[model samples]
Target chain A: MSTIEDVTREFEQIIPSDTAAGQSVQERIIQMLEELRFEDRDVFGIRLAMEEALVNAIKHGNQMDPTKTVRIACQIGQQRVRIEIEDQGSGFHPEDLPDPTADENLERPCGRGIMLMRAFMTSITFNPTGNCVVMTKDRSEPEPETPAGESA
Target chain B: MSQGNRRLDLEEVNGVTVARFTDKKILDESNIQIIGNQLFSLVDDDHRQKVVLDFTNVEYLSSAALGKLITMDKKVKAAGAKLRLCSIRSDIKEVFKITRLDKLFNIFDNRDKALEGF
Candidate 1:
């Protein structure tokens, strides 16, 4: 039921502005992927999603304060895997958030995280607490690595 | 946590080449090649067993970036190296899981573990 028995696979993380923290976030995520035995593209898909969420949480939500922290969690269920990201800053007005897909926002430097989150994740929700967000994914495909007798 | 305005950084850490980017949503289809090609060059050697992509700076991911990772993995594998991720933010991680990518790449807690895992 748990992927991170050693505390590396499944757990929570707090990030500072230092990009080094970003590296840790990336490592933990990919580690979970390898543990779960996903397909190649599936791996990329997950990384892409995770990256966008973290960047926004750190850069925009916290405004790179380095004082504010971004919190993360990963868990595995029988049929699906779940993740949550929370920030210390006051949440943005969802209505005020720009639409990245709109033609006017197309060339904007940033604002695509929400768009990609909707496209890639099976489900995404903003918490009423305004401090938390949750996302989920299902495991139904073949894995990229097949141990000795397993078929692709 | 300081604002870099979501710029992607590429460099070497723990002797492993990494692409550090801050993206907020699904990437536009056009940006894929630029990011993918750059990341590919870093992890494109068989001896180079690891590539860490830090997402703490990003808020979202588009499928375009997803395709880039898959293709980049292809090139890295052909070269005999490995591709991985670290410190993923949760909201975006959900997208990957929904896409079945949660089961993909070798994700770790940090670069040290990622490098040590190999």
Candidate 2:
């Protein structure tokens, strides 16, 4: 029998609604993901999801006003990782966003971020106010055992 | 790579203008604006009839950056020029695939391959 190792880590950062700050936040998240030994594809998923959320919070939610702030929190556990991003602006309904992949909408660029986040993360939800979004991705379960003297 | 202005390094190969994005993280608002303007300028220039964006050095691009690409693609087509992309990382490719922009643009594995289309 094998047991799952348990680890819990939490990080919080409050950054002004400046686009420059996004790079630092991305680096921090990448470091954390690397420490957990996540695979390149998983790291890319997390990075892309986080980038989408942070940019939305700063550019749309905060309107890139330096006076406003975006709050981001991350919790990583053995089974899963969760991230929350909240912005200080009037939130819009997520469902109202048009489908970027649609025939007529394919030329549009702004709606794709939400679609990418939905495609990468295991789950994505928004607060009632729509000002905050929570994203989660489950860790990969241990691989099934291979037969003796056989490669996986 | 020396920047022609701030965020992009431009060079002409044969008859195509290859504008390579230099930033590893292209999430900044200002950087997006600068890049978009530069690409639009290339689309408007008569000498630059063929434009290829080399994403060899770009690690990440925000939705705004993708939007700029779409806008540039449209402009390039309207101006009777060509817009091609080369050396896009898999992660970014996933974004393009999800948005179905992969079907909208001509993407090649390398600069030479992209140039061949022109």
User: Which is the leading candidate under lDDT?
Assistant: 2
After superposing candidate 1 on the true structure, give the runs of residues whose Cα lies further than 4 Å from its correct spot: A1-9, A143-152, B1-118
True contacts kept of 2: 0.84
DockQ, per-model, please? 0.09, 0.63
- Model 1 sits at an interface RMSD, in angstroms, of 9.6
**Candidate 2 DockQ category?**
medium
lDDT of 2 by residue, B8-110 (tens): 7788888778888888877677778877877787767544788889999988887788999999988988888888999998888988888888999999999
**Fnat for each model:** 0.13, 0.84
Cα deviation of A122 in candidate 2 (Å)? 1.2
**Backbone clash count for every predicted candidate, in the order shown:** 53, 0
Q: Residue A139 CA error for candidate 1 (Å)? A: 1.7
Model 2 misplaced stretches (Cα beyond 4 Å): A1-7, A140-152, B1-6, B45-47
